[model samples]
Target: MAKEKIVLAYSGGLDTSIILKWLKETYDAEIIAFTADIGQKDELDGLEAKALATGASKVYIDDLRDEFAKDFIYPMFQAGAQYEGQYLLGTSIARPLIAKRMVEIARAEGATAIAHGATGKGNDQVRFELAAAALAPEIAVIAPWRLPEFREEFPGRAEMIAFAEKHGIPVTASAAKPYSTDRNLLHISYESGVLEDPWFDASDAESKGMYLLSVDPEDAPDQAEMIELEFAQGDVVAINGKELSPLEVMEQLNELGGKHGIGRVDMVENRFVGMKSRGVYETPGGAILFAAHRKMESLTLDREVMNLRDSLITRYSTLVYNGFWFAPERLALQALVTESQRNVSGTVRLKLYKGNVIAAGVKSPVSLYNPEIATMEADPTQAYDQGDATGFIRLNALRLKVNSGVEQNQK
Candidate 1:
């Protein structure tokens, strides 16, 4: 009988490194290490070699940047999905795409089981497992961190390092940063370690060189930079007069937003697993796109239609944050969101200065804003009748008037 093949979501990091060796030893199976290249930059350096040296029978590093931006990020942005009204859903959005690819790889490689290094206490475990269950129910999920035996064997980071050394797995000093970060084309998230303290001054993260995407707002250039974004059906199509692909849009905007010190968020958010966590995220491109899309919608989307979609932001955001991207509710909600963006095509001019993305102007061919009737000085067309207000106000006040009369009669 052939040995069982287990596909592992390997990051080439300390945790995944140890897990790679442990899985091979514990299961006595052929380990196939897989890494998703979703714009983590140099983190992919020597990953294949590292995984192979760590006792993997085979290694696969796949690039999913364009698919990540177009399929995942753009759709979520169209729904105006912001977890807790602040997070751009950077890390939350990336997980589904990663997990989907992992499941696909598992099927292609004929692996019976898939494993991840996400801790039991974190949201990634839920995301990875849920996505796997939804996409491929037959595949088994092995979460070592959640297993009592695995936890007992390595209770702390020190134990993992010792195990790696004893097993001849390479360990680097830079793997242990003051805080942990998850980077992709959309953003870089900073959490854990010193960031666990909510009172910790995130502004001080600059001095420690903790941020990779943007500079400190105070150190940003003195002059503001003006940029224009073009949207087509709620997705950015052009930046500064250049038509680009979804991947290019993210790459260029990330550069522009980072140059101006935009998109830094620090907050305590409620994790899906019923716990509050402090996270700092740098989402330069995502921030710019979110603001520009809102401005574009203001010009073209109907008032009530926009309101209806706005009411679903919380639900939609929660769905994404809670690892329900493949759920039916999210799919149904996405259909409504896509329909709402039919007329949300426009261009928005913005001023970027010191971490602020200020909207300067917006215009669209399908704009509903009629300035003639809106002008306070005078309405030459007389589209809105001044006399209409009397009946409108009287009808609206009729209930109030009746309630007051009843109170007076009682008195």
Candidate 2:
């Protein structure tokens, strides 16, 4: 029998580094390290050499930042799928894209199985596996964190450190930090460790550093700034009179909005894996884009269509959060959601100031708000009959009136 090749999603972090060493020992498998650079900022330094030196047969570092912004981030912005109405779906959205790329790399490398460092207790495991099943079902999945033998062998951080030392794998082990964080261009999320203590207050600047996306609101510039966004079918096309690529547009927003401290959110949310997790997030660029896109939708989206889509947004958001993104129901709902967003084209102006995104104004050729039909002031030629409302109201009230009358008669 021959050993199978397993390509592990590697991040040069403590967990993935240990997993790389462990896989080589346990499975005797040819381990290929795949690192996707979806806007990790500077955390990607020396990852390729690190993976190879740590016993990987080969290493791949793919630049997926542009694709991440254009495909995953923009479509999510189009749907306005904020998890629990506060989270920008940062970690959630990143999962599918990374997993998709993982499958692509696996096919390229001729690996039979894929592995990731996501814990069974978190939502990420479901996300990684669901995406794998959707894109490449025939490929096997190797989840060390879930395996009884691995969990028993390396029960804690101390044992992992011991394993690394024994294998002569170079690693840095400071006392574990108070919180866990994930970062990308769209947003950064922090939770776990001391954050698990419900009553603990997170410092404005977390222990890792100030939030990746913003400065403190008090430190923002004194002057307000305004920008205009042009939309075509619910996606941002131009910024402040200049057209930009999707990644470029988001990058611009990050600069403009972060300087003003426009996006910070803290909340305790119900995780899909059945636990409540408290997270603090910075989504400066995404927040600005969301506010602008929604303002445009207000102008161009039809009343009934808008209402219907609004009804599904929460459900759609839940599906994404729960890792059901590759399911048939999600596809069906997305089709309907995208169909409604097609007419949502126009321009929106916004003011950024001290963490607030104020909708300055909006305009669209398809606007459904007609002043002539809705104005309270008299228009002599108005075709609307005010008299009809008297009957309409009476009819709506009839059931309540009848029920009360019966009660009074009985009394």
Candidate 3:
């Protein structure tokens, strides 16, 4: 009889590398390692060789960068989704895409089970398993960190390192500097280690070395840089008047935003699994895109429509944070969000300085702003009549007048 096959989401990282070897030894299963390339850049280099050397029977590295930007990232941005008003949902948004591809691979390879390296305590596990259950109900899901046997064998990173040495798996991990990190095109996040302390100033020398995407605000250049972004139906179509693909747009903005020290955040966020985790993130490109998108909306969207969409931001953001990307409610909400963007086409000018994205100007051909009604200067035959304010104010003040009379009577 052939051994049971399992597909493991491999990242060429310490935890996933160790999990690859452990799965082979414990289950005696044929491991098909898979890595999703969602703009991790050079991290994907030579990963196939490493997977094969680490006991994988087959290896796959899929480039999902364009899909990630076009499908996942843009839609979330269009909804103005932000977790806790700080995080851009960088790692939160990537998990569903990775899990979706893992399901596809599992079906193609005739694999019976799918595995991931997310620990039992974190939100990634929920995101991965929920997506797998929704997408492929028949396939079994394996999580080693939740098993007592696995935890007993390798209690921590130190033990995992020893196990890796015994298995002859090459790893650059060590007990020192055990800061956990997750990286992609949108952002790079650092947690655990020194960052676990909420009060630990990340700007200090010891913690500062962990940042990879952007420079420190103090080290940024003295002058600010201005750029223009063009949008069509709520999506950024061009930067500085140059049309580019979604991936190219993100790349360009990341370079420009990182140079100006934009998009750095530190906060204690509530995880889906009922814990508060301290995290430091650098989301240079995403910050710029978000600011520019909102500026464009201010010019094109109606006041009430924009307010209604804003009211749903918390719910929308929670759905993304809790791994409900495939849920029915999220789909319904996304339909409304898409409808709200129907006329959100415009240009926004912005200035990027040290740790700031400032809006300079915004304009749209479909803008509702009327200078004739807005101008304070008197016009001989203008439509506006100053006499109309008397009735408007009196009608609006009726409720307040009645409330004041009632309060006086009570006193």
lDDT (CA) per prediction? 0.92, 0.86, 0.92
TM-score for every candidate vs. truth? 0.97, 0.94, 0.96
Off by over 4 Å in 1: 173-176, 205-208, 403-411
lDDT of 2 by residue, 211-272 (tens): 66787777788888989999988888899899999989988999988899878888899998
Q: Locate the minimum summed-lDDT window of 10 residues in model 2.
A: 201-210
- What lDDT does model 1 reach? 0.92
TM-score, candidate number 3: 0.96
- lDDT comparing candidate 2 with the true structure: 0.86
lDDT at position 347, candidate 3: 90
RMSD of each: 1.6, 2.0, 1.5
Positional deviation of 83 in candidate 2, in angstroms?
A: 1.9
Collision pairs in model 1: none
